[model samples]
Each structure stands twice: as C-alpha cells, then as structure tokens.
Target: MVIILIRTVKYNLSKLRDLYLHTTCLATLANMAPHVHRLSAYASQRLVSLFYMLSRKYNKLTEQMDDKVGKGGSVEHDSLAKDMSAELHIYADFLRIVLEILNAILTYALPRNPEVVYAIMHRQEVFQPFKNHPRFSELIENIYMVLDFFNSRMDAQTQNGEWSVEKVLQFIISNCRSWRGEGMKMFNQLHFSYEQESHPEEFFTPYIWRLTLSHCGLSFDHNAVNLFTVDLPAEQLDNAGEEHDEPRQNGR
Candidate 1:
C-alpha cells in the first residue's frame, strides 16, 4: 500500500509539471483576468512574500558563514553549511520552476495575459534583488526582459499624460503581437525536464515527513528528522558499500 501510494504521488506530480509548463497555466491566468485587479494584487503579494523569505534566509545564512570564517571558526562554518544545503537546494528548485512558469506566460500568452504582466510589474521591486545575485541571476533573465519591456511602455504612458492601469491594459491589448509565428519564439533558453534522479528518497523522505506532521497538526521535532539523523547516515552507508565493492570488482 505504501509503495502504491508513493508511485501514485510521483505519477500525479509528473502530470502536474507537464500541465504547468504547457498552456494550462496560461489559459487559467487569462480566464482570471476579468477580475484582474484582485488577481494581480493576490499574485503580487504571494510572490513578494516568497521572494522576501528566500532573500532573508539566504542572506542570513551566508552572512553567518562569512562571519564565522572571518573569525577563524571552522566547526560553526561546517555546521551552518550542512544546515543550509538541503533546504536551499529545495528552495532554489522551487524558484526555478516559478521563474519558468512566469517566463512561459510572458513568452507565449503575452499581450493577451495582461494580468500576469500587471502582477509582475506590481511587485517588480522584489525581483530586483535576485536579478544580480550570483546564484539566482540566470534564473531571472527572462523575467527581467519582460519587466524592461513593460516598464519602458509605462514610462512612455506617464510622459504622455496621466496614466492608469486601464490605459496600460489597453496598450498591451493594442500593441502586442499574438502568440504565433515570430511571437512564438521563446525569449528564454530554459526548458526543465521533470524526471527522477538517483536516490530521490534522500530529498523526499524528510519533506514528506514534515508535510505529514503539518497536515496532522503535529509539531516537527528538528532532532527527530534532520540531515544528520537521516541523510548523513544513508550517505555514509553508501560510501562504505562502494568501498566494499571495490575489492570484489578488482578480482573479476
């Protein structure tokens, strides 16, 4: 039963990833545009919240590590590095998927999907911090392009006279190209594949355990489920197994 449930979850996740990358997400965003004001507000708020968390945590961790290293500290540096590795990898993947989704809408559903543009523009400031961060800079290029394009248009409108959201939407509807021919060309080179990597359990096990605890209204005991308790032991065993295999392989 457990095995079956895990397989089912993986299969559904695969389908979801496919649907998100295709037109389903874009179509949904367009359909929601009738209430675009509310939609944009909600979307921008959520995006800003996520970016804020990532920026705060990332900066806090890096600064701590730098401070420790500057003071000739070794044990604390290794401990902080271990603490950050898995969680940050998960966050980075999530941010990549999000940026890809945004790029898809902006690239293929553009001009028609003005709501997405509106939401992004409303929270453009949150995105700027990541634009040049060494780790996240590449993930944000397509988004930056879209921001630049719309911002330039908004500037022109402001110069002309008193500009408003209505005028911005009207301009997008009038001036933008359809999602076809030259318009179909993608501005971004990123196309992510959803596939299983080796030892995927190393990432999923802790995550699922936490999800289960949260949904069950239980507290998460950090010591009960941590990298040191789970991932490190498994990795050490794998390394030992590989070492054990070497002599047998050499005898063949």
Candidate 2:
C-alpha cells in the first residue's frame, strides 16, 4: 500500500510527506509489514531522483523570474506577475519540503532500517551535486552528514579489503547497535520538525481542496450545505435528505 501510494503520487510533491508518514506508521506496527525496509530503500532512491529533477526545474524557473524582475516586472505593477512570482516562491517551498521529508526519513529511520542506510551509501554520488546548491545546500547538509557517516564506515570496512552488496548489508545490520549512540550522534543532536509550519493553512488548504476536487467529482454546489453530490433518484434523494434533517431522540 505504501509503495502504491508513493508511486501514484510520485509527481505530486505536496503529497509525498503524507505518504512518508504513512510508511512510518506502517513501520511502527510490529509484524504487520515485513518488507517496509525494502520500501524505504526504494522510496529513498525515488525521492533522490525526484529531488534532482525538481532542482533543475527550480533553477530554470529561478532564472526566468530573475530575468523578469530585471526587466522591471514588479509585482505591485502587475497582478499576473505577482501570481507568477508567488509561484516561484511556492515551488521553492515545495523543494524544501521534499528535502525535509528525505532528511526526516534519514534522521528517524536510517538507524532502525538498514536498507535505508544501504541505499544512502550506494547513492552518495547522486547527492554530490546538491552540496553547493544555493537553495538546497543548507537542507542538504543534514543529508550529507548521514552520507558522510556511511561513507566513512564503508571506507573503514573496505580498506585493504573488498566491497560487495552482501558485505555492505551485513556491515550495516551488524552495526545497528551503535547507530543510536556514537554512530549517529550527529543525527541525535540535530533537530527538525515537520509540524513547525508557520502558515500551515497555505499547505493544508490546497492539499485538501485538490484531493476533494479530484476524488469527489467536480460538481460542487455553492449554496448547498453539503458541498458534493451523487447520482441518486429524486425520490431517494428527498427521503435521504428528510432522514438527515430529522432530529434524533437521545441514543435512539
């Protein structure tokens, strides 16, 4: 279910965090999900791909917005320009939220889920480009901390030796005991909260509105107390409405 939701909403950045939280809930339920680690591995990789893709789009949009502003495209002077300018900021925030989700997984789950550590270890190269990214650099720092920890451990293990997927996996699982202490001390010291949104309505309103409009059909009645409708016979609808309007006796 988590994989299905992640893939279904892969392009929808606004929904990814909820899916991550859903995965976390599943992981917390003991014995219910045996393959969640694999899901985490896949999710981490997919999110890495998404981060880079969105970063490129963000860079292009930033350049375009800068050009527009340079040409006297003032928000106060043009309502459309203002909307477009707001879009750039929104897109940047979306990108930041993506990093937040990824970092949250790494911070909260990497130690418990060996597969996530394994995935991050192998994908270290993909993260190099973001080290100096103007918009994402600070957010990516926490991720780099994790990556560096794994890289240092891998180097220590492989020095004057060899490397293999089995060996790496074994090392990660074997060292799980240390992750909560010295191995992940940096992670423990850092703090980030998804609940710290200053303007949550900005995020929640659009998400709820989009989900409702998309799933509950497009026919919304502004005057109706109930906003949505269904295809029902007029007789049945009247009866249903009467039943709904009727007052109920206590406990009856």
Candidate 3:
C-alpha cells in the first residue's frame, strides 16, 4: 500500500506541472492582444490629425487666393481712373490751345471789317467759346465796345456837323450795306433810336452801352464815361495788341 501511494503522488505532480504551463501561455497571449489593439488605435488617431492639418492648410491657401484676387481688382480700378484723368487733362489742354488760336485771329481780323466787328458785338453765340475764360472774354468785349463807340461818334458828327443828312446816310449805307450779305439776318434789327421822353442818363446806364459811349469820348454826364474807363489801364490794351501780334510772328 505504501508503494501505491508513491505512484499516485508522482502522477498528481505531472498533472500539476502541465496545468501551470497552460496558464502561463494563455496569460501571455491575453497581454499581447491588448498591446496590439493599443498600437492600432494610436496609428488611427495620428492619421486623423494629419488629415485635419492638410485640410487647414488647404483653407489657408484658398483665403490667400481670394485676397490676391481682391487686390488685383483694386489695381485694375486705379489704373482705369489714372487713364481717365490723363485723358481729361489732354482734352483740357487741347481746348485751351483752340481758344488761344481763335482769340488771335479775331483780334487781328475784326478791326479791318466793321461788319465783322458788329457781328462779334451783337452775336453772343460767336463769343460763347471765350465766355468762360476771363482774359479772352474781356479782350473780346472791349474790342466790340471800341468799334461800336467809334461808329456812334461818326454818326453823331454827321448828324450835328456841316455834312448833309443825305450825304451822311449815303456814306453809312455804302459802308454798312456789305454787312447785310452776312448770314446774320439780325443786322438790320440793330438801330439807334432816341425816345422822345427818355432821359440821357437812363439810356447809358447799362454797362455795355456805357462802355461803348465811353470809348467815343461822349459824355452823358461828367462821371458817366469815367465809371467804366477809369479801371481800364493803358497796359491792358498794349497787352492785347502784343498777344494779337504773336500769331503773325509764328507765320500762323
């Protein structure tokens, strides 16, 4: 019976060793499975972060492109405005040159033709181009006033002096008849008529009419001619004559 007990103890020891080896192998496999799952989760998170970074970079690039487009549009608008400004400056210079040329021509040519002088004085449309320009308008108006005053003086002399009414009328008819051929049908409309009851002071009150009489040395009153003539210096007349002579010097 003692021999049987020893054999049974040895069999139990071998079964216990087999059970311990199986438990160790199963524990190692369970730990390795959890480590593998952790590594996979970490790799997936890194991939998601990389995709997010790439999307953010793409959005930044798109915003930069939009800013560049806006800047380009502004540049184009500025270029257009500069071009328009340059064009306007060129046009203004051209108009100034034209006005200068017209002024030169009218100054020299009008004095030679009384009818042309009359047309210039009465026709506001003919002088419209110079109306905006102070210097040119003043010169034109002064020339018109001078011519009218000279003609009126000649008329007054013929009316009051030894010259017969028929002879004076004949001279005027001969000299002024050429003016009717001009396109202005209103040439006949301009006539000096004295009202039976009108005061001399009342007739010369208008600035234009006053200036005309002033140039002829006629006096409605002591201060009538002085009112307009006092301010006009001899230098202004000289300057006008000099300006008129420039075109002739240039052979224009």
Candidate 4:
C-alpha cells in the first residue's frame, strides 16, 4: 500500500486534475453513502450542491466545445478537445462513484441482501447517457468488474462457511479504499510527483491496489481524508481495538 507519488519537474495539468477529481469523487460518495449514515443534513445538502455544480460545469464545457467547433474554422480545435476530454473524464468519474455507492448500499446496507439482486438489471438504464463517451465506457466497465469481483468473493466465502456480517463489511470497506487508491493513479500518465517532506503529515502513498483491513476500521494515512473512518462508541473502542476484526485483502 506504499504509493510513491512521482513528482515531475514540469507539472502536468491533467495529473493534478485527476487527483482533484478523485478527491471530490470520494467526498461526494462518502457523503452520499447510506451505511455511513452521516447524521448531518448539511452533508446531504452539500452532496446535492456539489453534484449539481459538476453537472452544470459539464454542460457549460460541452456547450463551449460545440461553439468552438461550430464556427467551422481552425480556432485551435486541440484546446476544445482537451477541455471536452477533461469534462468527460470528470463526468465519467462521477458515474463510477454513484454506481459504486449504489452497489455498497444494496450489498451491505440492506437487511435482505438477496432482495436487491434484481436491481442490478437496471444498471444499463442508469448509464445510458455515458454509452459513447470516451472515458465513460472504460470507467463503467472497471467499476462493474470491481462489483462482480466482490460479489464473487462473497459467494465463495459464503459457500465455504466463512460468511459473516463483519467479513462482508470488511470486504466492502477494503475494496472501497483500494478503489480510491486506484483513482489517484488513474491520471498523471504524463507527469508524476513524489511526496515532499515540507510537512510531515502531508504525504501521498497514492497507490493501494489492495486494502489491508483490520478490525478497528480503515487505517489510511494519506492527506486526502478517507471515507472509512467509522465513529465507534467509547466503550466499544476501549474494549476491542480491532480484536475481532480479521485482516482482509480485497483486491483492486
């Protein structure tokens, strides 16, 4: 789980943008997650506001792209293409985040997990708008693959008589963190940056292709706050510090 950020002498805008998008996407999903049961109404309101803002920005950028291309002259089409591409990536990332949230809710939040199996059929309807988008297809596919991988693992564990509520929750939380790690590495193909020692706490171990889950909760030590921090009661924390939690390796 040691992610060495590869900083470059020349900063690439796309790398920074991807990291920023991942940050926003994690914040958005964490706020929206039902199991987390974020008790504050403000968090829900903030989620709505953030999504609306992103949607508006996507629309505006698309409109601008159309305007630039519609003039029918070479007004630097590359600039327009880059802008459109960035918007598409962000939107696609949004789509992935929402889908992952839904999966987590249905898989772990529901009392009767079997009852929610049919809901998986509606995924296509939800993602129809992203069909032909450059980034959407691949991102969606990857998310679903993660979904199926967890599902398959759960089934296997169930068959082997190792299934438990705690284990299932552990599987979900571990994979979720690993996904965030993968998101941080999604962009920055053009440039890389390692963590600087200017601040001891400000460091980036960006890549966690798999998560090592302990009983106590997620143990991420990154500058970007993680969503897996659960608020346990004082009694529970004092008595059992991950004593019941088993280490789980949920693959990326």
Candidate 5:
C-alpha cells in the first residue's frame, strides 16, 4: 500500500514536471490580451490549489509512516529513514515544480496596470475567493505585493513617494531563478540520509533577508512536512542483498 501511494505521488510529479516545463497549465484560462485581470485571478487560484495538493500528499505520507509503528511506536532512525526516503526525494522535485510554475506566471502573466488588479479584485466571482485571502496566505501575499505595486502606480500623481517597480521585479526574478536552480540541484542530489558524504542540509541554506522581501520564495523546508526521520526500507535491503550476490563482470 505504501509503495502504491509513493508511485501515485511520483506519477503526479512526473506530469507536473512536464506541464511546468511546457507552460501548458491552465489551458482553458488561456492568455488573452484583454483578459489579463481574469487570468491573474485564475493563476492565483491555481497556485493555491497546487500547494494544497502537494502538501496534503506529503502530510499523508508522513501520517502513513506514523501509523506503521502503532501510534508513534519506536520510530527509530532506521525505520523513519526507510519510510521517508522516497518522499524526501519527491518533495524536492515537487518543490521545484512549484517554483517553475511561479516563475512562469510572474514572468509572463502579471497584470500590466493597477486597474487590472482592481478588475480582478472587484469581479463578483473573484471577490469571494480572494475575499478570504488570508486563508491562502502565501499565494495571496504575493498577489497583494504585485497589486500594491500596480496600485501605487495608479495613485502616483497623488502620492509623494518614489519607488522603482523595475528594481523590485528584477530582485524577484533573480531570486526565483536562483531558487529554481537550487531546487533542481537538490533534486539531483536525492540522498536524504543525515550521514551522506554531503548532508542534504548543505543544499538548503535560506537566502539572507538583506534583499527584497519577495525573494523569500516557498518556505517548504522550514514550514512544510519534512523528511527528517531515518529508516532503511526492506526493498533497499533486498537490493543490497542482490548486489552482493551478483557475480563480478570479470570474476574479479
């Protein structure tokens, strides 16, 4: 059952990776010049939905491991690592999928003006979903930031302050690209054991806050369900046994 669950999550990740790379998400919510406002709402909604899916799956896997040991029974190092190994690797890839989606949307789909954000915010359909913005805090915070930028532009003549959207957006873009690169690097380095030659923690040093706030990116490692436990699965042991049993190619 656990293996099946793992494979199902793996399949979803595979599809998400393809979709992220191709930028084919939200097909029905296609990019029409006049519908930029509507598209932004849809994109925001999509981001929240994806987060729910991935986090729920991760929590489910963690719960499954917890279930196996008779209600937190003897969750020792080896048992925890065994169950969580596949999930940690998958979590890295899933996070990369999310970052890629974010980069694509922010790069190509942000509203060109403040009125578009108003259009989105004021729309009857969007109003209800966005009304409870705090519920989708992470995604909505980003929407609010971008919308605030556009709103300031709209009210610029009346305001006395100066700000550069270009610089801020550039800061955001650089962080997205850097974080995406780090996510991919982490995916490539899939070993989750604490004792690996280089600890997985080496890949996850968070960005210092001296830069723009938007660079915080997804705080998955810190906030979400983590694969911090340790266990070796029976399959891994079986594979090790087979490897030991196999004859050398040159009988050496």
Candidate 6:
C-alpha cells in the first residue's frame, strides 16, 4: 500500500508541471497576439493617404511662404492662403480618423501599454503635420489665443517691461520641446524646418512676440524700441578679458 501511494504522488506531480507549462505558453502567445495582428492587418486607408498627400502640398506652401516673404512680395500670399484653406478641409477629415484611432487605442490597447497612450496625450504635433493645412488654422488659432492669454497675464505681472525677447522666445521653445515623444513626429518635423531656416534669429524673435500680442487683442507697436541690448555689461567684459589673459598665461 505504501508503494502504491508513492506512485500516485509522482503521477500527480507530473500532471501539475505539464499544466503550468501549458499555461505559460498561452500567456506568452496572448501577449504577442496584438502586435502580430496589428502588423498583419495594417493598410493605409484613403483618409490617411489623403492626409499624406496634403502634408506634402502644405510643405510646398511653407516653402512658398518663405520665398515670397524673402522676396518682399505679397502676390503669392493670397494664392497660398487659398491652397492652405482647401488643404485644411482634407486635414479635418484626416483628424477624424486619427481621433477614432486614438479612441480605439485608449479604450482597447491602453490597458496593456499606458505609456504609449500617455505619450500620445501629451504630444502637440500629433496634429502639427496638418499645421500648414487650412483645416488646422482654427486649431492653430486656438493655440495662439491661449498663448496670447498667457502672455497678457505675464505682461500684467511684469508691467509690460518685465519679459525680455529672450524670455518670450525661451517660452516658445520650451512649449515646442514639451512635445517630444511618440505621435508628435509631425511637430518634430516642423520644428526641424524652423531650426534649419536661414532667417535672422532677431526677425523670428520679434515676429513671434508680435504674433502673441496681436492674438491677445493688443496691437504691437512695430516701432517699439527693444529695451534689451545684446551687448554684455562691463563686468562681463572684464570677465572675458580675464579669461583671455588666463589662456595667454597657460600658453606661456
């Protein structure tokens, strides 16, 4: 009877191990299934493809804007504006599909990968590829309005003189930087162009500032003197001299 009991115990242990192994295999497959399915089922839909085409057109518009502005010509502005408006309508349709994708991902896929969802949520340029599209003008305008409001509040706190051009430019750069992550590739692309442009930094500095002011119901004085000078103070000059002297001493 003791021998019989030992044999039964060994058989049960074998079954338990088999069961655990099977369960593990199933769990791994379950984890991998979604990725496999997404890859296999992926196909570019009409709406998405249309957006891609429009994005290229919008890029050309941006180039045109730069060219026209550089040449000091207004003739192309109206044509560019019209094209941008038409592209915006197409972009709106694309946005609807994107929204649906976001909703589905949030409702279904987010439980498994919350990090991706969070990244998408915080990204601003998820919609930025459409920025040059006329459809995105309203959204861009809304963003400008919000920034304008913030600038106004800052102006009030600093009595209109507290914020320097550098400060405002820094704020814009910071806002743009916060968009770095998945789903914000469009914004990243736009930023790349902005950085690559040969336009004078001073031109953009005041242009952005004036844009914010105009958005906030304030007319910027185009002739308003820049109180901030690029020149360093006398102390900084002295420090530079000392640094130069130290380098010479080291050479000696």
Candidate of highest lDDT: 2
Q: Tell me the tens digit of each residue's lDDT in model 6 across 1-252.
A: 212322332343345534333333323332332332221111212222323443454466567656766777665467865665565444444343333333333333433433332233234344466446554554344333333434454455544456554565444334433332233212211110113457677666876765665568754443343733334447768877898887455567
Q: Which model scores highest in TM-score?
A: 2
Task: Please identify model 5 stretches exceeding 4 Å from their true place.
Answer: 1-44, 62-80, 112-144, 147-252
Show where candidate 4 strays beyond 4 Å.
1-35, 73-77, 110-252
User: Model 3 off-target regions past 4 Å?
Assistant: 1-77, 113-123, 126-252
lDDT score at residue 185, model 4, on the 0-100 scale:
13
Please identify model 2 stretches exceeding 4 Å from their true place.
Answer: 11-40, 70-81, 129-138, 159-162, 181-252
TM-score, predicted candidate 5 vs. hidden true structure = 0.29
Task: Report RMSD for candidate 6.
Answer: 29.2
The whole-model C-alpha lDDT of candidate 5 against the native structure comes to 0.42
What's each prediction's TM-score?
0.50, 0.54, 0.23, 0.33, 0.29, 0.23
* Regions of candidate 6 where Cα sits further than 4 Å from its true position: 1-40, 44-54, 75-81, 92-100, 111-252
lDDT tens string, model 2, 1-252? Answer: 544544544444445535455333322331222223444666656556665666666677777778878998886888877766776776676566566656656555665677766766776676676679787787678777777666777766645557777887788777765665334323222233344559878767766765776588677543352433335547767988999999989977
TM-score: model 2 vs. ground truth: 0.54
Backbone clash pairs for candidate 4 read 5-193, 5-194, 6-192, 6-193, 7-192, 7-193, 7-194, 215-245
Clashes of 5: 8
The lDDT per prediction is: 0.55, 0.61, 0.39, 0.44, 0.42, 0.41
RMSD of each: 14.9, 11.4, 57.1, 22.1, 19.8, 29.2
C-alpha positional error of residue 168 in candidate 1 after TM-score superposition, expressed in Å: 3.0
lDDT of 4 at 46: 35
Candidate 4 vs. true structure, TM-score: 0.33
Winner by lDDT between candidate 6 and candidate 1: 1
Q: Please list all clashing residue pairs in model 2, or write none if there are none.
A: none
